[model samples]
Target: MPSGSVALSARPEIIGGPPPGAATLEARDACAWFGDRLVLEGVDLVMPKGKVTALIGPSGCGKSTFLRLLNRMHELIPGAALDGEILLDGNDIYAVGTRAQQVRMRIGMVFQKPNPFPAMSIRENVLAGLKLARLKCDDKDTLVEQSLLRAGLWKEVRDRLDSPGGALSGGQQQRLCIARSLAVYPNVLLMDEPCSALDPTSTRRVEETIDELRGEVTVVIVTHNMQQAHRVSDLCAFFLAEENQPGFVVEQGDTLEMFSSPRDPRTLDYVEGRFG
Candidate 1:
């Protein structure tokens, strides 16, 4: 959470998972603040199960903030706090006894930059989460191979599973990061500008991986690139930061409709390149 000058007018109530015409993940009246300043206000959204939802907005509009909040990553920042209900499969993640560690294990994240454990090998990185969870594995090697194959990196690095994770290209490193997330068998994946630092070829490869991941896990991505959002998402949420208020959701709908027939004029403007 960070200080911003946008606020939401209406506060939408919590709608649990699988509501009538609803999606898998829902957030109701979610408000976030860092210290005294509000960043998100009365925001609401639904992400369909096994489908990709893209969050698009200008920088500082709280797109990334909201993405992090979906899985409680916002709390990792100093002085970050929020009010709202985030539901996953009808369970309120903020309820008492709800463990953030368990939430993280089920909802994985990939950052703007590739981050693999430098000291670990490719094989080791894929099994890191399982090890952290203290899962006993009589044949951990099978899990590693399956995870790498699912991540689309096994063929590229099969000969060198023992090689250090740092030795791969930027794209490969990001894939390794994804493989690490997959090792935990998460139900949802949150990506924060995951391909911003990658080149076109690398970006394509990552996009391909995302395409393949659909139907396996719910995906929510925060991205500034409109084309990329259009390319990968089935649903879209638009956010904006306005004067004297915290950032808020402007509109959310089917990806094609949001682009072709946005309800808010501001959303139309942002998507049509009238203003970022």
Candidate 2:
């Protein structure tokens, strides 16, 4: 562990320098609409399995919308419709008879807010994903420890696994949510502004967890914080949506290179803080 970094060695299975997942993801000419309003269009992206990809842009640019589209989450909205195909390892996730629940099982999600089930204990929260998937683990205690360790929360709450998840501080609750997401062993994790509500220390811990998850799980994140994007991502895509125009990919590439030398003026401006 580096100086100032929290120790996260309790679960050595997820020490990620390179991704170690089984499938890759690609979106070809993807488009989305909320009833009669078009929010995103002509979107294409490829996120390699076991790597971290960051989606950064101004608010309302469809970053979160695109993240939700990956697992058919948008279908939950009435009158919501989409165009194009999102593929997981060359297989269309939207193919007929494919269950949305199954797709979500393989690609888990962590939202911006720390939304631990209020009535559940920390241990229960950590194992929530498995329950949602209707899977049972024989070694429940071990699973909780490993998941919390992977989320960088094991040491603090190891002795109080039965405490209500909502009783935790905002940061701890967020990490608990992360632990819950990891418990299911999803191949890809989708995060929408995961650190938006945390303090600096909490944000750093979450970032470390994301770093460690590399090679163990593919992570796609939407963020307004460019610094966070540059730190945790292997690759990045800049999205833009202007008045009367649907959101589209402005540019994308290696994170370091994209920040240091962007191909488009808008990319350079956004990265340099000239404009969002």
RMSD, each candidate, Å?
A: 9.8, 4.1
Residue clash pairs of candidate 1 = 5-245, 6-245, 6-246, 7-245, 7-246
Model 1, 267: alpha-carbon shift in Å? 1.3
| Candidate 2, 157-236: lDDT as tens digits | 99999999999999999999988987766778999999999999999999999988887778999999989999999999
User: Candidate 1: worst 10 consecutive residues by lDDT?
Assistant: 1-10
For model 2, what is the alpha-carbon lDDT of residue 30? 97
Task: Assess each prediction's global lDDT (C-alpha) against the native.
Answer: 0.81, 0.86
Off by over 4 Å in 2: 1-22
Candidate that scores best on lDDT: 2
Worst 10 residues of 2 by lDDT: 11-20
**Candidate 1 residue lDDT tens string, 222-251:** 988999999999999999998777999899
Q: In model 1, which runs have C-alpha deviations exceeding 4 angstroms?
A: 1-23
The estimated TM-scores of all candidates read: 0.89, 0.92
lDDT for predicted candidate 2 compared with the true structure = 0.86
